[model samples]
Target chain A: MYKIAVDVMSGEKKAEELIKGALKALAEEKELELTLIGEYDIISQELAKTDFDSNRLKIEKADQIITMDESPVKALRKKKNSTVNVGAKLLRKKEVEAFISPGNTGSVMAAGLLKVGRVKGVLRPPIAIQFPAINGSTLILDNGANTNCSPENLEQFALMGQLYAEKVMKIDNPRIALLNIGEEKTKGNKLTKASYELLNNNPKIKNFIGNVEGRDIFSEKVDIIVTDGFVGNIVLKTTEGAASFFLELIKDSFKTNLLSKLAAFILKPYLKKSLDKIDYRQYGGAPLLGVKGLVVISHGSSDSTAIYNAIKAAKKSIEENMVELIKSEFAKNEELE
Target chain B: MYKIAVDVMSGEKKAEELIKGALKALAEEKELELTLIGEYDIISQELAKTDFDSNRLKIEKADQIITMDESPVKALRKKKNSTVNVGAKLLRKKEVEAFISPGNTGSVMAAGLLKVGRVKGVLRPPIAIQFPAINGSTLILDNGANTNCSPENLEQFALMGQLYAEKVMKIDNPRIALLNIGEEKTKGNKLTKASYELLNNNPKIKNFIGNVEGRDIFSEKVDIIVTDGFVGNIVLKTTEGAASFFLELIKDSFKTNLLSKLAAFILKPYLKKSLDKIDYRQYGGAPLLGVKGLVVISHGSSDSTAIYNAIKAAKKSIEENMVELIKSEFAKNEELE
Candidate 1:
């Protein structure tokens, strides 16, 4: 059985909804056990409303909660019983196989780095998120973690991202591409050029596609795209903005008139399914890879579905022993270097 | 009168179609002169079919043309008679007020920088583009040029972008914002934090509205969004992908059945209008700002409409004397510093 520690006092406005979703997911999936970290009274009250088995749900009391506006370092240092601190502590002690949170991103990242620590030889741990593409999803790493990164950090990101694609996403021999301005070897800034050279020289990479431009990101030409946090965050947010804008445009198109509204009803199911396929929330949260312990960080605006998926994602990481796999991979690469 | 040099050999296909569009635009607007730069024989042949005035439409012969596959810098040095080189040279010599091309971006930027040079105090020139937002279009700088930037570079980008909006876009007292991970001053990486401090203290910027996150990009929170080239490019491309994806979804929704097809017709005009509002091609091309001479770069696959708008944009920049304005602005700021 996979045991996961979930921060119940996370997200902006949907704390109760998340707990309810976690209970529902637990009820449906029998092989999962959840340790809900939050205020005892509030969580217990919400838990009472749900019809989940008492054995599947375990409560861990936390007196403090970190606000989104608070400094992550300060909050993590001061608030000993905060949800993020408690969840991370559990993962460190091996009490839970994995820890998941949809709270303050800075706090989660801080706690993960401070409490769980980094994998040996890994310069910096990066968060990898799945982006929907034509074939399936592409693994985009360092989506806002380690903003300023070296070429070596990007090379490490490629290795970890490739492993995640193969082991977790079940893609065999995933093609990795260095995100760049053009496909040419001589293209892009010094960092991208250096990273490209490293990736090309590294024989461990299955298929090293020279360079993938921004336009070809959604074309599914490669399975793994490795870049620094600054570029990665822009790509992530831009995708989110674009998705939201397009969804709004479609909704506006459907509401134009009665006839279009009727057409919308006929095609609503297929459209929803298509949107769902591309939705990042369906994939739960981005996993903070290269860390000693398993940690998954979701969006602050995450709903119940996102929380449930994050729980499932954490369980999958635990079951697959991703942390150990990553450590071993890094150890081997370091020795070779 | 606005005299603009138009490169006929810039796009992927249909040079004649683009010329025809430019002629049409010139016919509708009386105070414009177009110097159509291309192969003299081919341009004359195409012009023989149209009734455009020979005086307003001057054909210039260029022996060499830059191919899409060729290296931009290498081609610029070798192919001196290329359309891009010739047009940019004309602008540099004060023969034409501004030079516009719907062809190779790298060649245009390379030729523009090498031939025209940059405004004093400008470390790197940024290519700025306007995005169709809720209130109006917001100016985003360094769309794809100058990937790695320092805080000083971003500060210059903001000042230039602000001038573009106020002078050309005609927005008085434009609000400038630093694009970041969060709205707080201490939210972003070292580069952003330093830029935030610089922008906050600068008196040249009419309104420094603090930091705006990715979600607020389309909103009317600010007029100019300043970011590094890496992030800017990702945002630009992701928006393009999402727009294309959403439009495809709408088309699929319309093809669900015969009834849906009918509904599509009913809502077609309104949908088209909304799509047109967000159509980036309507804005012509992104200008390589901070260059000594006016240089505008369009996409390789730009259609006739895009070429025409590029010419129009070039004309406006010429009339506004953007290069001189940038020089004066930098000079004044240098004195203050």
Candidate 2:
């Protein structure tokens, strides 16, 4: 059985909704087993409303909940029984193959680093998120984990991102590209400039496409784009903001008059269907890669459906043996060096 | 009369369209005079098609044209008589109050730095562009000029961006904000964490907001957002790309079925009107701030209308004495230090 730990508390949604998602994920994947960490009474109360297989599911009590605004370090230090901390401990103790959380991103990352630890030869763990593209999805690494990074960190991110894309994402010979201000190899700040040379020279990285601009994130040109967390986070949030801004503008236009409002009503279903490709929920959670164990960080405001998808993402990571692959790959590279 | 030099060559569009824009700017602002630098024959031929004031418009013959793909440094050395070079020379010689170009952005910035030079006490010149906001607009500095920046560079961008927002954008006591991943004062990479203290501690800055995320770029929160050129450029281009991607999706949605097509046809006019606020053409060109002379960098793909609005933007800067204000503000700060 592929055992996973789910942090049922700390997200914006109620624990009941998150439990419903966990149950749904259990129902879909027969070989999957879950240990839901939260207030035992609350989990029991929520699970009482659903029909779940008792053999595949278990409950672990954790009273404290880490909030969105709390400092990651402080929360880690004080909230020993929090859902995120319990989930991390589960992964560290080998009680679960993977851990999933929709709580604070910083907290989850910290817990993953401190409790679960890094893979044997890994330098730093990076959050790799997939952006919906014209064709499928483009994977971008170091989404917000490490704000400042060295060239070696970026090269490692490129390798790990490529492995995730090839194995879990099922892209063949994924084209790896550097996220840069300009497409030219010579056109970047100090970090990207030095990173370009490293990425270009690495024989282990196949199809090392030189550089791509922010606009190319959604384009079908590249499979994986790597950058420091600072730029990646800004690009990710900016794209989200810009998409919402345009959608709002469209809605306002539909309210201009009676005729336009009627037209909007008639076209609502089609618009939603077409726009689903840009929706974040469909892509599931961002995986905190390079850690010793699989850790998936979902959006804080994720609903049951988003949570369900995130669980599926963790299942895929576990099935693919992503952490083992990363460990062995880095071991091979170190031997070669 | 405020004399301005126009680089009639090097943009993606034909020179005739650019000359037409220059002529329109001259017609609208009677006190505005333009020196159009391009091929003499083409300028004369295009001028014959329109009825323009000869006294307000003059042609400076330059046979060479800088292609978009040409290296900026090599182009500057080889194509000495290119339109951008001639325009920069006019600003340097005090023959024009301002210079405008729709050519290669790198070429324009290089010429501005090598030719007109920096303002006294200015460390580096930054490109400041205004993003279309829900209320008015938000000014973001270091758009693409200096990719790598120190904390002091961002502080200066704040001051320069504040001055432009007040003088050119016509806002009263513009609020300056640092673009960061999080809103907290301590939440950022090395550059932003250090820059925040500097911006907050500076007494000359009238209103310094703490921090804004990428999602806040278009929100009606603050006036000026300061960031390193690398992050700023990515945000700018990512915003542009996301907007276009969504618009394309909307268009595709309308073509899904017969009824949806009818609705789209009915809503076209209103959609265009409401979406005009997000249009890049309305914003004109980005100003290269902190330079001793005014240098406005228009988009490479700008058409006649965009070019016309850019000239009007230059006219406003001249009327407000924007360069002089920045000079005096920095000079005063130097004395205080």
Candidate 3:
């Protein structure tokens, strides 16, 4: 049975809702064990409201909660019993196979890096998110973890993203593409051009699809899209903003009159399915890859569904032994070098 | 009277459509003169169809056209009489106040940089596009021109963006914010953190707003948002993609049944206005800031409306003497240093 640590004190709203969601997930999956990291009295009271088995649910007391406004490094350093710190510490000690937090991203990333440390030869640890595309979801790495990166760091990101796609996403021989301004080898800045050369030369990256531009990101032309944190963050946030804006536009369109409302009902099912496809919260949290221990970070405003999905993602990553797989891939490359 | 050079061969659609649009623009305004650069025979034939005074329009012959696929550098070097090159050369010779193209971006930027050259003390030239926000449009600089940047380069971008907003957008004392992961001084990667420090300390920048994340990009928190090209490109493209996706979703929603189609008709006017508000094409093209001459680039798939607005934008920039303003701003900073 795999044990996972969940940061119950994290997220912007409804801590009890998150607990109830976790309980729902536990009921559906019999082999999973959950370690709820939060206030003991509050969690115990919430647990008493649910039908969750007392033996299966373990409560770890953490008096402090990391606020979204607090500095990540300061919060992590000072709040020893904070939910994120406690959860990460459990992962480090192997008390839990994985840790999941829907807290302040800075706090989660800091706790993961400072407590867990980097995997060997991993220059920069990237957070990978699965973006739902036309055919299926593509694994996009370094979504915002490492802002500045070296060519070697990008090379490692490609490998890590590739392995994650293969192991977790269950894609065989995932096509990896370097995100660039143009598809040409000579295109983009020095970094992307240099990365293109490295990714091309490296035999370790299976099906190196060369360079893909920003427009092709959602087209499902490649399985893994590797980019540095700066660009990755922009892309991620822009997508979110755009999605929200479009949803608002559609809602506005329907609310214009009675005819539009009737029309909305007719296409409601298909529209919901399409909306679900791009819903980031449905994918749960992004995984902080290339670290020694497993850690998943959800959005700050994530709800119960998002928190539950984050927990499931953590459990899946641990079960697949992603860290060991990444190590072995690096070891193979080192031997070849 | 402001004379602007218009590249009639740039867009993907019919050249006649662009010519007609130019004619319409010329009909509306009596103070502006346009030098239409394209194949003389085709432009002459199209011009004969319109009632626009030949005295107001000057047709210049270019033997060759720069195809979308041709190397920008190569085309600019080889095709001296090409529309883009001719227009830029006209601006250089003081025959026209500014140059506008709805054709190739690379050729426009390359021609502007290699031919027009940069403003003094400007290490790297940037492209600035005005995105329509809820309150008003915000000028987002370094959209994709220079990929790699130092903290100092970003500082220059901020200064230019702020100046553009103040002068063109007519916003008095525009708020400048660095695009980052968090609002704190210690937040973001090395580049962002460094940029934040520079922006925070720079006294020249009026209303130096703190770091704004991607979520706040569309908000009215700041009038000018500055970042490196790499991040800027991702945000720009993601916004474009999301807009396209959202439009498609609306289209699908409207076609679900007869009831929805009737509703779509009722909301058509309101929906069109909303979509038009966020439409980047309506903004014409991004301006190549810090260049010696005013250069505006429209979208590759730009239609007559976009081309017409591009010409108007070029005329406005010239009237305002934007290039001279930027040069003086940089000179003032140098004197201070």
Best by TM-score: 2
Would you give me the overall lDDT of model 2? 0.90
**Candidate 2 chain B lDDT trough over 10 residues, lowest sum:** B240-249
Question: Where does candidate 1 stray beyond 4 Å?
Answer: A257-259, A334-337, B256-262, B333-337
Q: List the residue pairs that clash in candidate 3.
A: B10-B103
Using all chains and alpha carbons, the TM-scores for the candidates as numbered come to 0.95, 0.98, 0.94
Q: Which prediction has the highest lDDT against the true structure?
A: 2
Docking class of 3: acceptable
lDDT of 1 at A314: 77
iRMS for all predictions? 2.3, 0.8, 2.5
The Cα RMSD in angstroms, rounded to one decimal, for candidate 1 relative to the true structure is 2.1
Q: After superposition, how far is residue A14 of candidate 2 from its true place, in Å?
A: 1.4
- The number of clashing residue pairs in model 1 is 0
* Model 2 error, position B289 (Å): 1.0
Deviation in angstroms for A268 in model 2?
A: 0.9
User: What is the C-alpha lDDT profile of model 2 across B67-144, one tens digit per residue?
Assistant: 888889899889989988888898999999899999999999999999899999889899999898878889999998
Residue B196 local lDDT, model 1: 94
In TM-score terms, candidate 3 sits at 0.94
lDDT of each structure?
0.84, 0.90, 0.82
Between candidates 1 and 2, name the one with more favorable DockQ: 2
Worst 10 residues of 3 chain A by lDDT: A241-250
lDDT of 3 by residue, A10-82 (tens): 7887679788768877887787999998999989998887587777889999989989888889889889989
